[model samples]
Each structure stands twice: as structure tokens, then as C-alpha cells.
Target chain A: MANILTQNDIQHVDYKDIDLLKQFVNPHGRVMSRKRTALTAKQQRAVEAAVKRARFMGLLPFIQK
Target chain B: MEMETNLSEEGGVSRVYEIGYLIVPTVAEDSLDKVVGEIRSSIEKAGGSFIAEGAPSLMRLAYDMTAREGDKNVDYDRGYFGWLKFEASPESAIALEESLRTNASVLRHIVFRTVREDTRAKIKAPTLREVKTPRTTLAAPRREEEVSAPVSEVDLDKALEDLTTE
Candidate 1:
């Protein structure tokens, strides 16, 4: 599996402040489902909403197809 | 003196009332101006004294209505906000509400009574508060609370014993 946390691992992906988002997210890029980043469903939703708002405001890049 | 007594005894013919309505977004902007003009005429005809008006704000609806006549596939409709404050008889408000309910242009309407003498007085005589109040410092209260708590006797004894031993 490609390393999700590393910016280099995602090819042609659009992300606003890739470094900042990486720092906020888990090392695996996948949040939760692990003990190190023990975030619940609510926390996940908050993160998703923040990311969506950032994208809509042009602060973050939308994921490229 | 007899006319004044009769007028006072009859409970007067005036009351301060507020009417507000929301216009559907589908209504053209030009149509909105026309609707407002009609309302102005309606108020004048009803013998209501217009006081003030509130500006429009874009707000989300609590629920979506699927049954607008012109809109076939409307997921939702935008509400154009408006408010009118006036002095009129209670019966006039009832008549206005009935008219608004029958009108297709209005998305929602409500009328409320404002009878507080102080509220009306403030309208006529404005207060002078030209200067904005400065925000108070929060850190000062925390520091004062910390200083007010009594020191533990055990801790004081321990400090004195350490000094003597040294």
C-alpha cells in the first residue's frame, strides 16, 4: 500500500496545505481504526467538514480525478 | 372634556404592531419591489402607523416545502426576509394576516404586538452611548483569586523547618 501520510506518495492529488493536513491526520493518512490515532466517528466527521469547507473556500485543493 | 373622557373610556383606537414576511427566492427581484409597494398601500389603507423596518438577511429554512406552485423540482426555496413595525388596531393585524395567508407571493408571515411604553419611548428619545465599552481584562481576576486563597499551615511549617536545618 502507498504511504498516505507522505505528500510524495500521492501522485496528482490536490490538497490545500498538504503538510498541515498530514500533521493533523495519522501517519497512515487513514484516521482512526488504530490505537495511535484513536479518533471516534464524531472527530472524523469534524475533520471531514473542515476539509470540505477549506476546499469550497479555495483554501484547500479538491482531490483530482 | 366629555369627548376626551369618551375617547379614554373606549380603550383607544391605536396599538403598536409588528408584521414580518419572507418572500420566495423564485419571485423575480422586480416582483419583490412590487410586493413591498402593495404592502405599503395595505398598511396605509388599514389605518396603521408604520414605525421601522428591518433589513433582509439570507437564512436557511427549518423545513423544505415540496409543494410550491411554479417550482416543480425545487429541492428548497430561498426566503427573502422583511420586517415592518407599525401602530394599528389589533383587528387590523388580523386582517393583514388573513390577506397575507391568501397571497401566493409570501412564503411565510407573522404579526406580533409590542406594547412596552419604554420601547416606544426609546424610539422617540434616543440614548447617548457614543463610546463603546472596552473589554475587561480576564487575567486580573485569576491572579486576585489565587492571592486570596489561604496558605496551608503544613507548607509554612515545612519551609521554616528547612530554613532552620540549613
Candidate 2:
């Protein structure tokens, strides 16, 4: 299947939006299972990578410490 | 298992540092090189290697810092955000913090520790590299014009004259 995230989709997502992150991740800090999210493995990985980058840049909260 | 534990704990892998600093805006633009050099030398002296430096990003302070002896009444710092990832002893890290704190040029600073292993492994394990879109010729000139604007050297004399006239 064609990956759900196109280049434009990734470009529009700044790796900083909290709601976009929540769509791919759970409050428990785990990536949402691909079956539930309906994302191909590649798109899933991309979402996970973007979330990590967002957390690193202080744009997203990874875990409550 | 004990041997593995000892090896893992020996140096415990180096901690990565991400440091940011704010300096006085009135400082001459040309002097940034000297200031950054001084900071790098200090980090190196404490056994750290500088990794990455970012372009200065202008920022506003969350709160005003009260002026004391030499400080002006208003704290207006133009942030020159730099990122340095280095390996150093914990003692050296403490010294680095102290040096940044004492420097008159630096208005504020913070050091965050991160893991290099994750970053390193991500880099080493190659994935499909996307080819960048070819730059259109028409777009290149616009970018160059924007870059070539002598923003740093514009109208200093006129600005000073304006101040005097006022």
C-alpha cells in the first residue's frame, strides 16, 4: 500500500504539533499499534521519528518527569 | 554477566550536552567569532569536543532580570543560540556551567544531557535517502538577493545622525 504520509503531509507537519503527535502516539508513551492507526509500517516509523524529534526540540512532551 | 556489567559501567558511555546562551545585543556582530571561539576553547580545556553550532535566533526573555552593580536597569539580551554535543567528564561539565555563568557576555545559559547512542545508531543505520528537489533557476536569484542584502552594514551613519537630530 502507498504510505499514508505524502511528502506534503510531512512538510506541513512541523514535528511540533501536539495533536498531530497524539494521533500517532498514546498517553502511555507507546506508538499506537499500526492496526488501530491504519498506518503502514513506514508511515508509523515516520510518525515515531517526528514525535521523538519534537520531544527533543521541546515541542512535545515525551513523558511526565 | 559480571564482566559485561563492569565494562558497561566503566565509563558508562559519554553524556551529550546541548547548551544555549544569550549575549548582549550591543556587542559588535564581528565579535561573535571571538566569543564563540572562547566558549569552545573553554569546553575543550575541560575535555569536550564541540559538535554543532546554530545560527543566532532572536528571543525574548520570559522575565526581566534585575540589574545589579554593572548590569543595566533593563535586561535585553539578543540570543545567539548554539548547540554543542560533546563528551566530557562530569567535573568538566560542572566547570563548563560555572564558566558560562561568570562570563559577562552570557546573560543566560542551560545545559541538557542527552544520549548519543540513539543519535549515533540512527545515523549509522542507513535508510532510504530522499533526493532533494532540484532548485528552479528563478528561485535561486530571489534567495541570493535576500542573502546578499547588506543588512548588517546598512545606514549606521544615518541611524546615528537620526539619533542626534532627535
Candidate 3:
């Protein structure tokens, strides 16, 4: 799939937006890597940071339970 | 009092803030407002000015969070959700966080400094992540004495010989 960011024309990702965050997460709740998602280096980093924040805030789980 | 790292690029010394908090769903609508109002007052008390906010909405939590009510452990499966965008002095933001931590009705919360959507800029590359505490895969401790010892063949043979001798 094309990188979700460019496909949707989303420049910045918000940690609070679960809908957008979900797209970056795998079925097992792991965040997809740049290689897997085919995201640019910048986009991948943005997702990683957002995912970490979301997980810490309980918006997303570190692992599927 | 503490200070946020980001200084406003806008026409002020204070930074813009985004706060997200989850409240236990069991609270009545009136009581919910009361709790939020308390938070608002606390923020103001610390010298923060309130900005517009979305009304709190009841939502099912992704997972149950255990909360202690009196002496009992209460499992909160649902939560009242809300987000506020405001401008506050760094000192007041720190105070707001301290108050949120002590608020009993709050199940979880997070706060951060943010730029306006219109002025949002390029993304920054992140460094490798560090390992953190595990959220799952619990290993309960088991004492060796609690496990029954396995019976050996020698022991069984000795028991048979002892019975015959008797």
C-alpha cells in the first residue's frame, strides 16, 4: 500500500487521533517499520513518535492483550 | 512550578497546550462537568487562561483500568473522553499536570505543547527507541518447595523391599 500519509495528504500526525494511528499499527498492535509501510524516513519517524506517545497515554497498547 | 520547553511563536510569552484526559464513565453528566470545572479552576489558579474545548463524551476504553474506590479495586471499562486546547504559562502547565495526577475521577491523562494547525511545520527525524517496561508477559514467581518432588525408581523399590521385610 502507498504510505498512508501521502495517500491521504496528511503532513503531520497527531498522537491523539486513534483512527490515523490505527492505520500505522499492525494486527498484532506493533507499529509498522519504514520498510514494511514504505513510508519516507521522515514519515516513519513521525509515526514512531506518535505511536510511542499514544501507547504511553493508553490510547494504544504496547502489545495486543 | 515547572516550565514547558516550547515558547509560543504566536504573539505571546505563553505556550499553547493540548490536554487529553479520560474520566471514569460512571460519573453523572452534572458531576462530570463539575469535575472538569474543578480542573479548569485549578488551571486558572496556576495562571492559565482557558480556550475552547470539546464537550466530554462517554466512550468505551480500549482496556480496563483498575482504580481503587475506598478499599475496593474498581475496574473501569468505560471512560468519559475530552480534549482541551489552551494557552498557558509554562509554570501553570506544570501545576495543571500535578493537579491532574491527584484527580480521582481521572483514569489517565496526557498534556503537551503544540503549535497551531495552520502553522504546523515539517516533521523531525527520530532517534532509535529505548527498551521500556513490559506491559504483558507476566512471570509469576514460583518457589521450588511448592513443587512436589518427583518419585525415583530407587525410592519405589526401597518401599517395596521394606513392605516385604515387614
Candidate 4:
């Protein structure tokens, strides 16, 4: 199945956009990969980078309690 | 984890980096600016020039950070979050990280090589200062007394009070 990001025709994922990235992050604050999220390989890579950047900026946590 | 280098418009060797750093929330808004200034100065000393993305915003931490103060454990619940994009060489990146690590006001910081964009930043390195002192303005540089003195809590109180009065 095509992921929602692609279905909606979103081009590049933004690391600073926390609201959009939150959907792909698991409860534990980890970004889900293509296997679980069904994102295209390219999109998955973008999401991965976005999530990591968000974590470092404290928009998201390394681990959630 | 991988370092990618590219030529720039100025024909100087420079690489872009994404820097994310956290400041402890206990610092007053006045002192916070000082902390940021110090960090930026260190970055300049290490040959990195800051590219302003935006102003940093205060944020709540996702997990509790408990640390031992004098006797009781203090929880760092909130922090000032900032993101910066800068251009520098690989060696300067190391120096930048080291400076951030030593500063107590910085609770956390991370630096990584970001994918380069088309915009080019001029590459120039600042001279190394022999005396390590907390810097202020350019005029007169600093006072003789302040050069050897450390940042005292009384100064912090004065700065914090300024926030309320004005």
C-alpha cells in the first residue's frame, strides 16, 4: 500500500515539522521503517533523517517513559 | 555518520553542519542569551560560522532528567531548544563539540554533517585568543577584573531581575 505521505503527494519531509513526523514515530519515539510504515524507500530515508534531527533538537525524545 | 564534502561558490573548502543544542531551563531569559552568545563565540573560534535558521523556543523534555545537586536530585523538566546550520571543516566540528561539552549551561548538544545545499558561505577563521575569558562587546573588549573572575551567582540574580523590572 502506498503510504499516506505519497498518497497526499507530499514531496520532501521536513525535519523541523514535528506535527507531520509524529505520525510515523512509534509510541517509544522511534521512527518506523518502510516495512511497518509501507513508505517508499526514498521516503523512508527522508523520514529517518527527519526523525533523527527532531530527536536531537528535542522536538522528540530518544525514549519515552 | 558519513562526512560529505563539496566545493562552494567562494572556491573555499567548507562543509555544512546541523547543530542542535539544549539549554537548561533554570537560566533566566537574560542569562540564556549570554549562554547562546558564548556558544556562538566558541563556534566562531573553531572556524564555524552560524547560519540563522530561526530563534530557539522553550520546550518540555519527554523524559525526566534527574541529577544530584548538593543533596537532593533535581529534575530537569524543561529546556530551551535551538537548531543551527553552519559551515565548517571537520576539525572545527570537533572543537565546537568540545566547547559545548565543557559549558555547564548546555544540557545537551549534537552535531552532524548535513547534506550540502546550493547556498555558499564564506570561509574565514578567527584568530585564537590566548586568554580564555567570557566575552562581552567589542568596545574595550572586557574589563581587567572580569577577565580573571568567574560568572558569579550574584550576576545571574542581577540578570534575572532585569527581566522582571523592564
**What fraction of the true interface does each of the listed models get right, in terms of native contacts kept?**
0.00, 0.00, 0.20, 0.17
The DockQ leader among the candidates is 3
The whole-model lDDT of each prediction reads 0.52, 0.56, 0.74, 0.71
Question: Please, what are the lDDT tens digits per residue for candidate 3 over residues B21-73?
Answer: 88887789888889899888887786676665767788776667788788999
Error of 4 at B72 (Å): 7.2
Q: What does DockQ give for each predicted structure?
A: 0.01, 0.06, 0.10, 0.08
lDDT for each residue of candidate 4 in A1-65, tens digit (9 for 90 to 100):
33757555566565666766776888888888677788988878878988887776667788885
Give Cα distance to truth, residue B95, candidate 3, Å: 0.3
Residue pairs with clashing backbones, model 2: none
Show where candidate 3 strays beyond 4 Å: B1-12, B118-166
Judge the docking of candidate 4 as incorrect, acceptable, medium or high.
Answer: incorrect
Which ten contiguous residues of candidate 3 chain B have the minimum total lDDT? B119-128
Candidate 2 root-mean-square deviation in Å? 17.7
Name the DockQ score for candidate 3.
0.10
List TM-score per model, in order.
0.43, 0.45, 0.68, 0.64
Query: Which of the predicted structures, 1 or 4, would earn the higher lDDT when compared with the native?
Result: 4
lDDT digits (tens) for residues B16-121 of candidate 1: 7666677776777667778777776788888776778755444454345343566564544356667677777667778888888777777666675653222211
Error of 2 at B22 (Å): 1.2
User: When superposed on Cα atoms, how far off is each prediction in RMSD?
Assistant: 22.6, 17.7, 16.2, 23.1
lDDT for B22 in candidate 2 is: 63
CA deviation > 4 Å runs, candidate 2? A1-65, B1-13, B57-72, B117-166
